[model samples]
Target chain A: MPGPTALNFSEATSHDMFAQRLPQSKDDSLPQVLAAAVTHLHALIRELRPTQADWRKVIEFLTDVGHASDERRQEWVLLSDLLGASALVEEINSRRPKTATPNTVRGPFFRADVPQLPLGGNISLDGIGETLDVFGRVQDLDGDPIANAEIITWQANAQGFYENQQPDLQPEFNLRGCFRTDTDGRFHYRTIKPCGYGVPDDGPVGKLLRQAGYPLCRPAHLHFMIKAPEFETVTTHIYDGSDPHLAEDAIFAVKPELVRTFEQQGKGWLLKLTFIMVRARRGAGT
Target chain B: MPGPTALNFSEATSHDMFAQRLPQSKDDSLPQVLAAAVTHLHALIRELRPTQADWRKVIEFLTDVGHASDERRQEWVLLSDLLGASALVEEINSRRPKTATPNTVRGPFFRADVPQLPLGGNISLDGIGETLDVFGRVQDLDGDPIANAEIITWQANAQGFYENQQPDLQPEFNLRGCFRTDTDGRFHYRTIKPCGYGVPDDGPVGKLLRQAGYPLCRPAHLHFMIKAPEFETVTTHIYDGSDPHLAEDAIFAVKPELVRTFEQQGKGWLLKLTFIMVRARRGAGT
Candidate 1:
């Protein structure tokens, strides 16, 4: 059992002045997570010893982050990405086995309505970057083929802008598509190689990146959401290993296992990879 | 010299995958506080092990707080107050001599443009509640009177709303005024006895309070910002000792020294308080 604990600040009688506001009934439904958040916040305040002005600066920064977010742009996601919170959350939840494919942030740009295409179909409607063929296979952890797996993919254009970001300039669903694995569990797509680009830098998250001495660049990568009949859906990214920004992705979404090399195939690039899926628990449907 | 510290998580290679994203420039302006915040956040994530859905909930709640704020209301401040961050900040900055008045949150409702009134002026322009006379004296730590001191005050009307919150119903500047201390450091004013009232309960903060099983009521109190020549300016609040909410002020602004009793006088209540000031540092200005 946990030891007895004080309800407020550990030191100074007047400090935990807010302790009186704790719920009068022990049956209050305040989740343990919220209580933990409060405890962490108190510990932060105690450790940092912030003055009034400093506290106000933080409050204002958060408010600005909120005001900066909208349907098209998620400044909160950018803020979480910049602070490494998003990465940490992914790390905590995605503890995968060595044989299974790792999970990455789904990111804010994902859409559920990507168009379905045939095998080896081209997803780059705008055709702005060097043409490349991405061929990959889907299999279970034991190497059994997971045929008919649904594979959804999206990536930023060569210039690093998602199709939605420049709707007026790019074609609808410019670099987004969904494909099904063949009988042999193989799937392929044609698209321009994604390039490193900065996150939206016109808002408060950008201000924070500048203050933290971090550039806004996220390394080039392809986002994927894969699902099979008996496996859980997985959201992930495969990064270009050669990209310099791989070591300094603005969102910290790069994992070594997710970094793949694009082979030089004449004037274009070619990527061949495999994805391993984990079986879902009984009653869990993909 | 300090010992070496690992750049990321200690247990797994994948978890610290983002370690490479740490700033490459040694001279980066990442404040120590910001670094600490990131560390604490990582610790929280590790402890809670929240899933993607759980993380998204937090992001959505904060966004709502931002969307709720405007020129008249500050939801971020309300969040901080509810979480006790505001009280903690005030406590960290308000260490004072035993005889001096303790400090409290300025609260979001204070307006600097309050009407300046002569001694014994009536500040209750709405004339809606039981009339009361408030008398106060400003004195230094040595118990000597500080004449010509300025007292800026504001409070919720009897209906539990600030004039700015209900501009359409309450008279302009219904319960706000500024007064100058007399030769003996005394000041007096007439106003309706303030009542305990709930905080703005229609925003995300209210949602949080309800979730946490807390009522939104703050104890009855008068806000004060006192300034005297060559003395530190103190922002504080004095609570009515008889208020039932005094023991559970939502914002925790009630310091023992700031609680005063109201004496029955004729058909109204009379409150007497002593405002104590500390000598400002030689170069400090209010």
Candidate 2:
């Protein structure tokens, strides 16, 4: 084949021109990184051989994603999540030892500084669904219990809405609480078992799921943020293995270690698992 | 590797789930098209293995592009154009016979319903720069002239800003005119030579270009849209071959065949060329 005549030449030459354009800076290489991304994306488009209409559709979709975003709605995050970029990012950034608990997205509903409760304190303020006692031990890599670790937890209610999503309908702090691990490293709390539900699908991402024939649902799961003085703070999820969407989370965040069985008790359910934490890398905790 | 244990499982399996989730629709296969884009993008991300920070940077850049867009300014089009998608699209959609003039971008400044003028009429209202008499013949593939073809032309003023960019400074239709070919398929009009300048670079794209160290300039050129009954309408640019940025057009829209030389005359410049048109595909004109 003729090597990129002017008629066939935009990508390669421009890629080089773009790559060489990055300004040299010591503060951040983000500009260089972005230039590389542009080049790669250009090459990919050329490989795909998209029509003008196809390219316009992409531009429109991205514009809609931006218009959909807000402090509360974060449509860009939703887009990243749907595209599996968020999961990939989480995986790349938090590479834990095999024995430590796997990380998942700290979904938008999490709030800091919730009231710290004692063991087995109930966090279900609205009385919306079946209750469950989620008890777990915070352990170190060698299986030693980590005492006094702070565990902040939250999740959507049984009907798929977070308390923040319907502040008018739900009471304050509905299904949100913070607790501390005992000397034995065990912590427990009571709240409604979070039901699997679709993500906020009313936005552009939702429109995409609706059009693509994909469900907007994320599997039922519990959100946890665990912190200890000597260990890396971990933000993650514990999915109910039985949730129908487990195999197809909208965010593609499922990890085998994070899936736990919720057994039926007399009145509600019981979930017990041991979370292992890895020591923070030197200077990482600061 | 144990076939994607907790640390490595999401992408491979979820890719399938995402592909299968696309909705079945007969109205438009946009969903299918989106599915393919998503799949390709996901695979590309996997290949690139971008860090969490890298991914976040992309999200932020796209968000800025969206926020920067408006009816008057198309930041996303600038972005696509900079990345060469626009050029690729023009290449893919406007495949012409060897003799036909190649198509390029109809940049944001083009205004439809322009005032039509007689042959040898003046298009320049401000008379801001050295005048040029541009004469051309519209011909068919076999080199026979096509009489009475409509030639729509527009370009920047001497200062490198389109008339639309500064309505207060330049008169309405300052450098825009539509002319009909005379007998023997010849058309002529007078307008000042456009000066090369950067694109609208105060927006996010400008920030990006600055950060990436790219000159935002495009070569000086005249835009043309030619149409005739029973023939394909052609949108193209005739760039000044002497413009310094000819080899580095910001939008990558420059093609070898579109480069023209300006010959100096007694009081102005003369740019003469033959534009070949191809017959319209059957039923396309209806």
Candidate 3:
């Protein structure tokens, strides 16, 4: 077979030529995404005009990120979250009406097999930290109750470590559980107040953040993935408004609508909020 | 400590907030580069508007790329080269005058331990493939001879396998050597003609190319790193003009000025060329 045309490459022509040479993929979006990525990547290179040594450092950083990721950890996901790519992507893909709860990052500690619990059931197995009572209603945009909605929630302990991160100290699924909304669309659960936590800062992503002088702490928040048959599942977090890190969440995930103040009730804290979900369009798969 | 100001994130505000929250670093360039990266990255995400599934795929791809790289291979480098970022960076950083030889990628197979060889010494240790002679004169941009210039070279065998790739089949350092110019800036050596070779396609980079339908084969070429005191060192490749893959070099590294044809001479092939060097600026480091 004849070779491709011999075209010279300069900074001006490299990107366009690279995009032009991309073979058509069976998946249409693949090529489109690849093309966009190349365009932006080349633009970054052009903007940085990094020395060869600078480029090598980038490669080394990426390699370290890869090496730090495995079954237990996802350094790349952490990187996306830290860079605000994840939150922006979540915003773009999950654009909803004003009434619907905004989607944020699901984070990296979610477990799929948490045991189901009844109303007022406590998810905190260790019973550490100050007590917290969480009561919420699930409703559609029109204020109608959405019964039997599954609310899967998880959070870090008082010390800012997830059960998964402290397997030896915390019980399996501690501060994690699944609850079902009642006929009135009310779901109540009890747990300990979660404190602000730092992302895994020992990895390359953390190293980059430190070198950039960026904070590593995410605000105290409770993850909630609520799914009802006819409504789009919203993977989101409710931030503790009083938490000092709310304003500087390392992930840029805090939305004013998703932040709630924890009222002091008796000797414990009470958090009462409502989750508004958007109905899935007919034939739309969530 | 007081929390940073609370800022709501939307598709439009996320990028700006992320940039604003980045604390000042000790290194000025760190924040600058990061800001540029965030700007471009957010733009790419806005352009693609990839679904959550698509974003997950990207993260997975990066993870796989990282996992596929180690001491024996550099999958990230391959990814960078295939995407044309490396070549662009080379072009941007090594912008020399028109008279100087252009710099290309140094590739990953170069070694510093190859023993220096006398003029006319053969580099083909295995004694395989068609015999060929290469003679070249190293000269300054003004055509003055640059004596004692070091020319470090390496290439795959005629069968398209580097010695390191097939350690058991080919002797160590086969088709690899370092040659220095004589008092007159003349150097010559004998080696077998190199053949086109596929990059390591078994890795994630190769898998990506296969899926994208991009050719994995690089053009037949010999690697060269020419260096001399008081002159900028040039890392480049000289492509075989007749090779069909010249136009489709996997790394987009082929330059028209670097292509040469082997002339038939005494039942062997002869390649005669001149190496042009650009003098380094006073007190400048190579």
DockQ of each: 0.42, 0.34, 0.54
Candidate 2 TM-score on chain B: 0.88
lDDT of 2 by residue, B1-286 (tens): 1124323445565455566666667676666666666666676676667766567677787778777776556777777777666876786677788778988887767888689888888989877899998989999999899999999999998889988788789998889999999879999989988898888877887777766667678899999999899988888999997887776677778888888899989888999989999988897641
* TM-score, ranked from best to worst: 3, 1, 2
What is candidate 1's lDDT per residue for B65-177, written digit by digit as tens? 88888778788988898777888888787777878897888887878888799999999997889888999999988788999999999999887889988989998889999
Candidate number of the best DockQ: 3
Regions of candidate 1 where Cα sits further than 4 Å from its true position = A1-29, A113-121, A167-169, A182-184, A283-286, B1-30, B143-148, B182-184, B282-286
Comparison by lDDT, 2 against 3, better one: 3
Query: Which consecutive 10 residues in model 3 chain A have the weakest lDDT in total?
Result: A1-10
Ranking by DockQ: 3, 1, 2
The interface root mean square deviation of candidate 1 comes to 7.1
Candidate 2 lDDT at A157 equals: 94
TM-score winner: 3
Tens digits of per-residue lDDT for model 3, A1-286: 2433455677788877777777666566666677788889998998889988899999999999999988768889989999999988888887699878988898778888889998999988988999999999999999999999999999999999998788899999899999999999999999999999888888899889878877788888999999999899999999898887777888878878888999999899999989999989998767
CAPRI tier of model 3: medium
The i-RMS of every model, in angstroms, reads 7.1, 5.3, 3.0
Off by over 4 Å in 2: A1-43, A107-125, A142-152, A163-190, A228-230, A263-270, A283-286, B1-40, B108-127, B143-152, B163-190, B227-229, B265-270, B283-286
Q: TM-score of predicted model 2? A: 0.82
